[model samples]
Target chain A: MMKPGTRLKSAVCDAEIMIIKIAESADLSCGGQLMAEAPERTEGDGDRMHGCLIGKRYVNAEETIEVLCVKSGDGSLYYEGQELMTKDTKKLPSSD
Target chain B: MNIALLLQMAAEACPDRCALTHEGRHYTFSELFAAAQRAAHHFLAAEVKFVALMDVSSPAVPIALMGAAMSGVPYAPINYRLSEAQLTPLLDRISPAYLITGSEIVAEDRSGWVVRSSEEFMSVVSEGEISDLAWHDDPSAVAVQLFTSGTTGEPKAALLRHEHLVSYILGSVEFMGADEAEAALVSVPPYHIAGISAVMSNIYACRHIVQLPNFDPQVWLTLCAEQSVTSAFVVPTMLSRIIETLQQGAMATEALSSIKSIAYGGGKMPVPVIEHALALLPQVNFTNAYGLTETSSTITLLDPDDHRAALEQSDGPIRARLGSVGRPLPAVEIEIRDEHGAVLPPLEAGEIYVRGPQVSGEYEGRSVLDEAGWFPTRDAGYVDDEGYLFLSGRADDVIVRGGENISPGEIEDLLHQHSAISDVAAVGVPSEEWGETIALAVVTAAGQSITEDGLREHIRNHLRSSRVPELIQFVNELPYNETGKLLRREVRAWFAAEAA
Candidate 1:
């Protein structure tokens, strides 16, 4: 089972994420393609859309699946072509 | 999932920005990354299983911390204050380690360790040819090991995995959120969990770091001005001393003009001390963080807005939050449960149970997490109707007298309100009449005195008769550890000698 801290790479574009969480048999995709655990195929230069940020977290609408983008990509992250929204951070004081 | 990714990301994002400042030197993010890379080579060359740091705040802290992560070894910071008899065995446990300390001491008991002074280690790592070795990416691997200061037993080795710390950083801190002019001053000692989290969070925020080697209230105020520090973390004891120094009005406001925010934790902050601080430094923002080493630093915080709101209202629910530690972080969930494992409602104090991705309540030999992934923190605290938390002393410190439970925090808070008392600690002592009787070690205010009967009369007026202490001693000061934790175990011993 895919768990938190598991890394996944996009087969279509230069998108990489670490799994914050995943649902049972949830469809995890990036750039409209299913991401893979191994780098079986190198990323290609695709047109950039809905730019994914390197340090941003993405979650589905129901918010069951979550991922943290480790590398900025040319294509946006999605769940079977449905775009996941960026999670807003609740800012707290910088306590050491 | 190595913590090295944090530094690498910062270096790549802003290579030329200032990352650290010590005695008189400033290192850019790129320079710090290079030093870490060099240090990784040292750990690899020596083939050490762990990188142990036994020193105070210095450049070597980051070097060893990041370097150890890059080399796939746990970064264990040992408490150097431990005596030779108590320290030798701990060093042996982390044998084949690269020990970095303030001064090189002869390890008359160990041979596998490579001991080097922090200065020498820094110089050596700077001179070495850079090794481009990649960091180990195992998320479950241990990132840090801290030894808890147990009064009666051996110190427990608490372990934090890479995932635990990364989750905390991701949940609470924003990446590159700090502005170019923003700098954070860190004064906690190396062995403290806050010390490690300070370095981690600052690197991710891309803020400049200024280190205070030794804690002197005057020196801290002077350095804040010289370095243009915007934020800082201080223990309760340190904050009280700084407040005392500021009361003298020895220097102009310009000496502390750069300070913007101050965060305090590591002990129960006396209400009077915090109230005085807020009144004096009206321009400064204050935050109270509460957590344990196993939780990878703070799990809950009282933000500045909450602090202001609490101060604005004197007697309402809003003002009550001043004593509260606020709520849990977004990623964490907290529940107060009784001894029978039944969930308690709001305003009921019980054992604090927490469950989250960042809670790694694992020791060297045993894991404290229950089957449901919940870790029971031995601390005693309760939540308000709105989810704000108020911490009492440790659950173990609760005193039972005549089959009634009494919290020392309630007694200490009332004592703090007394005009003649400056600091106080209420502890349980062995008693024949009752199971345990309350004892007070009170520190009188400057140029003030109060008789034991007068103090008891004051307590009896506000609280119940059971809350009044049977034994009271007007001492000059109470016992606190280096990190500002009140030594209750030692406080309990104070009355023991007199009774004997």
Candidate 2:
């Protein structure tokens, strides 16, 4: 089980995800491929269809997990074999 | 995950953005990242167990902090203002460590440690190549070890794990949420939790930080205007001084107009100072952040909205909520319990206990967490019906007079509202009849005086007759630590001597 604050990378592509919430027995994947523990520089041909931009957050369908892309990649994020969607931006309260 | 990952993320996302500013010098996130990497290599070469900074805030602060985190070692920042007598014991505790210090503070005997001047340390770090970009991300690894200020007693080492700090940042702050032009001015001492928290939070939010090692009201104001500092955090005493400086027209209003928000904590803010600040700086947002080092900086913040609402609202109950420490963070849980440990209802004052992912509640060896994971904060407070937590004072500071538990904060707050009183502290002194009686030490406003009879009548009319102080003495000023915490222990001693 991936825990919140855990960083996952794709061995097949440049996709990276930071886990926001740990789901029980959820299959977290990227571009139809299982995600690995660290990022790979070389791009893979598993899925070249979607792109992940830096600073954009990707979330699962149930919204139980959210990840902000700190680095851009060619592969799209997936969970339970479904493509993750961009979450609407919510204004966070200022805490200094 | 290691807390260094926060800095790594910032460097990856905005490498060119300015990460830190000090004395007109600036370093980008990329430069800071590379510098930390180099410094980590130096630490590994020196075979040091910890990277300790016994100096003031500067570029070296972030460099050493991130370097220690990257090397999987604890980073400790010791108070530079402490005298040699007080500082020697602390240095002895962190032996076999790498100490980065300023030139003037270097001691003759440097046994069991490697000491490097800040300039020498920076130059050496810059000489090395940037390697080992990936740091060990073990969540259990200790990140920063801070010494408590020891206001009431001896200082203890409070440990903050990487997971604890990371959870606090992720739960309280948004990722890359700051505007590109936004900058924060940090004046709190590096040893204080507020100083450390400001650096991590601002870096994660991508906000540029300007450090002020020695706080002067003029320098702070000047830097705010020149840097266009949008945010700042100050202790209550600093805020009081700033408010006084600004109110005296010593600094231009235009200089301070650029400040969008200011957060004050690290001590209880007197009602008069905060009210005066609100009246003077109407444009700025005011936040009251309340937390302890054991809780990783801030578990509760009276946000800007709460500040504005309390000022605008007319209802007394609603307006008085201004004095509260706001509600607990979504990730933290707080309970008020009586002496026997029974949980108290809202509006009933009792000992404050907290449990959360970020609450370390730890020292070096002994864990303060109870069987149920609750850490007794040893602070007496209550939550209003609206869930706003109001702190009375430290449990040790409470006064017991003739078997009646009385909070000194209540009396102090009431007396502070008097027009002639500038500062006041209520301490319990030995009494012959009553076991202990409250003695009030007061500082009259500039060129102003109030008779002891007049003050006694004010307290009696405002509160019950039992609440009136038995002994009231006029003093020049009350003692306070550097971080703005009242030295109640010292105050009681002073009052005792005066009575004798």
How do the candidates score on chain B by TM-score?
Answer: 0.98, 0.98
Steric clash pairs (candidate 1): none
B462-495 in candidate 1: lDDT tens per residue?
Answer: 9999999999988888888898888888888999
**Which structure among the candidates has the greatest lDDT?**
1
Residue lDDT tens for model 2, B318-340? 78877888888888999999999
lDDT of each: 0.86, 0.85
What docking tier does model 2 reach?
Answer: acceptable
Q: What are the DockQ scores of the candidates, in order? A: 0.57, 0.43
- Return the top candidate by DockQ: 1
Interface alpha-carbon RMSD, every candidate: 1.5, 2.5
Give the TM-scores of the predictions, in the order they appear.
0.94, 0.94
